[model samples]
Target chain A: MTDLTLTPVQTRQSHIGKAVLRWSLYILLGVFALFYLMPLFVMVTTSLKSLEEIRTGDLVALPREVTFEAWRTAWSSACTGIQCEGVRPFFWNSVLIAIPAVTLSTLLGAMNGYVIAQWRFRGANLIFSLMLFGCFIPFQVVLLPMARLLGMMGIAGTIPGLIFVHVIYGLGFTTLFFRNYYVSIPAELTKAAKVDGAGFFRIFWSIFLPLSLPIIVVTVIWQFTQIWNDFLFGVSFSQAGTQPVTVALNNIVNSTTGVKEYNVDMAAAIIAALPTLLVYVVAGKYFIRGLTAGSVKG
Target chain B: MTKWLEEHTPKLVLAPSFVAIMIFVYGFIAWTAWVSFTRSRLLPKYEIEGLIQYERLMASPRWETALNNLFVFGALFIIIAMVLGLLLAILLDQNIRTEGAIRTIYLYPMALSMIVTGTAWKWILNPGLGLEAMIRGWGFESFTFDWLVNPDMAIYTVVIAAIWQSSGFVMALFLAGLRSVDQEIIRAAQVDGIPTWRVYTAIIIPSMAPIFLSAFIVLSHLAIKSFDLVIALTGGGPGYATDLPATYMYAMAFSRGDIGQAASSAMIMMMVVFAIVVPYLYSELRSKDD
Candidate 1:
């Protein structure tokens, strides 16, 4: 009875304890942050150092002098095969493939999401469920058949074919995101629009589309990163001259018996990663907001 | 009429994507299934040999190697990825400083292609050039980290690299889940004198179960399909010790010119994935319905 009556005093003491506990959590988090950041530190330092320095195993040591020679070599003169040209040629190809693939996939995924969420259609659940199930199947299981189908269509080894492939595989996640997001929006909004004599296409284009910016950004960033970093389909579908930057990077980095250019490889990696990293930094808030929105809104 | 139109509109809207998927995706899956049944060579032939490809698949040394390696690698990859991912999420959820920086650093690997990241890990794990040599330089003359060269230990190395590459995505998924957990619950637990670890293990974990399961399924699927890392890191070498199903399928068709065998291997992989996926998916649907 006395303890219950003196609960305020107990609460004050607990507050102080909680404050201390929170500070300790901050400290613990700092340590983990260091662990996650260490590899990137090594990568950047190795990229800046000369091959001679790297070979001498001074990885953690500050470079004698920072140089961009490795970057220059990696971008221009590093040998992927008999040719001495670096990863430049593949950059354009990757961009070309990525842009169309990302745009088309996002558009289709948005439509899929809009329809499934807004319209109560027969077989909609089944189609959506099948797609979701398809997402679980390892893509490698389908690659052989996909390749054969492409060959039959005479688009095997073509960029369009590769784009089609990425879009198909990307559908599950994109549609999942959009559908969930659309679900979160009040059906009243669409109802009001319908009451005002708005049709499906108009409502989608004006109302739903504008409201979908966050998810669209999420879809774009996700798809861009995925298509840009994709190696298997790029390599499997396209040959040497038409290969993406990933394939070029692979050919350069994975070459056996060639002189190992550790500095060049690191530079190339950083270069390849630059676009997505930049996007993430620029849209850091949106990605998290988008994720939160998709969940909470739904 | 209105109800009929409402029901039919979604189907019409979804029809193009579905048809495209069926033709390009499921159609190919069926075609591959067919190829698996035939005794095709190189670029898939029409010669029917009934179950010969399956028998060959059952007997092939490489196929067995791939299957065994994938099982071991897949298990390790999923377990480690989930553990590390959950841990990172928990740590990040503490309202820490430099949250964005840490998240970005962890996620940067996923931004790079496997070719680049896998090759980097290969270099870092290489006995002569990486951690081993670095240790020797530090006066440990007896130091040896030659797992990359050892047939038995090679797959473990792949797991290490793969975990590094994938754990970040899991972390991202988990962090989102953790953030969404009700703060009121944590406050209540705190007021009740429950320890933070106890709260996490008891309240937080259960609440985050669905998202964690989703992340697990995603990571496991990624592990099962993992190909590029294996190719870039070991090339399935050191006597095929690091081979995975994807690489094995590719080798059979492209390298060995045995399309029938490759298709069979692919079919086997599908069956394995289907076995794991179908039941889980069914339960997921049922749960959603409820």
Candidate 2:
């Protein structure tokens, strides 16, 4: 490759230059990685420090005395509002919201994908386009009316209300994921099933569903991170008792009146971020695939 | 009956979702538009009025500030993120040994929520408690990095935090785009004795226009709906100096109880989104038809 780019007279100089370029590239990547990892490093060290150490020590220094008290307090006893019960309840609220929301949205997307891909009817493209538009609209556009609609349904400010909102808003991306995945699948399998007297549900249940594991993983991880990290819907729809972890983390970090415990705040931020971070670490390849699949094709 | 059910099963499976989106997504947009034209206060009112809320929105200084901040934040955030992301992608494309570790480190931030990003940056940028103090303690007694508190500079802190969180995801997108470019083209350019950088500049980057557009669309949308980051970091603070439309809308609706203002602000946001998105979608769908 180097010889292809360089003439014989320039070979030695070009080899030296290429080596220089290679090292420079590594240096550039190193600098960027440092910049990217700095905040997480600070958050971890700060969360581990005693409050006294945080107050007195250098911001970048390792904690002189490591402690897990802040994590414990953030999880069990930090006051966000009138309740001093910490983020425990809100964490559960997020779990409740995310589980059903991811499950329902993924299932609905699979079904929608199956129909749109295999059982194409007239106007299916139109319906898919309409749903695609749902992905782009700013959520602010629906806030007031959604609040009103939730009120009318008598589930406003509840965990169920938050779940419904996530599932509804999530349909676009989930459907897009499944539809794109299913479109790549050959149509012959479904057609063959039809000839064997298999109906829509049976063909989908036995064949498409089994074949959908990869896309389903992508969709579930995508939806799980999205719904779990959601703040707008969580903050807008749910109140004190049912607020999700993201909202609670915000309130805990931003609440004014008491002495600001930087350690506790850092711990709470890490706590709020842990689940998604874990998913990314364990399945980052799938996460990247999902992200690229969603954006690159659009 | 069997025949009818067979024919209808797919439609039956699709019906609930289609109806939900028709109402929850499209229907609510219409409702918000209607409410934006009304004189609603703490609660929504159905009575029709004519642009009164918009008139108020235009008159309010806070709304103006939010719009200006959005423009500044959006422009800087998008441009910087794309450039940095492209640079990182180009660097990673050099076939470095530590590419996987570095890529993972860069992309990890995107996995976490904006709220987490905001809080971490908030502490990092805090004048008395964070960077300033740390630098001062290192014997640079006169050093200061206090954008987190300065009213005029607070919005840029949001910009900084946003770029940090998103540039990695942008890199991932661009990296994928870069990798997909045919190796044969580079070989051809190499045979012509073109410099490596020039080959990339002239041939490679130009071919990734679609990826560039996709990144722009995603980043701009995230910027436009930037409520959580602002709320968690600055709370549009130093007297609303950092308010973007998203945070402004939330404040008006949830805190100030001015539902009319919220609705109008939201409509304006939606208009901004539509202006950027609809044209792109039109071109995309049109091209697909051919």
Provide the DockQ value for model 1.
Answer: 0.49
Worst 10 residues of 2 chain B by lDDT: B280-289
What would the per-residue lDDT of candidate 1 be over residues B186-213, giving only the tens digit for each residue?
9999988797899999999899987877
TM-score of each prediction: 0.89, 0.97
| Count of clashing residue pairs in every prediction | 0, 0
Candidate 2's displacement at residue A116, Å, is 0.9
Candidate 2 lDDT by residue in tens digits, A1-298: 7555667769888788889988887887888999999999999999999988988899899999899999999999999977888888899999999999999999999999888877899888888889989998999889888888889899999988998999999998899999888988899998998999988888888998888888999999999999989999999998889999999999898888699999998999999999999999999998988888777663
CAPRI quality band, candidate 1: acceptable
Off by over 4 Å in 2: A1-13
The number of the candidate with the highest lDDT is 2
DockQ for each of the predicted structures, in order?
Answer: 0.49, 0.88
Worst 10 residues of 2 chain A by lDDT: A1-10
Q: What's the C-alpha lDDT at position B259 in model 2?
A: 91
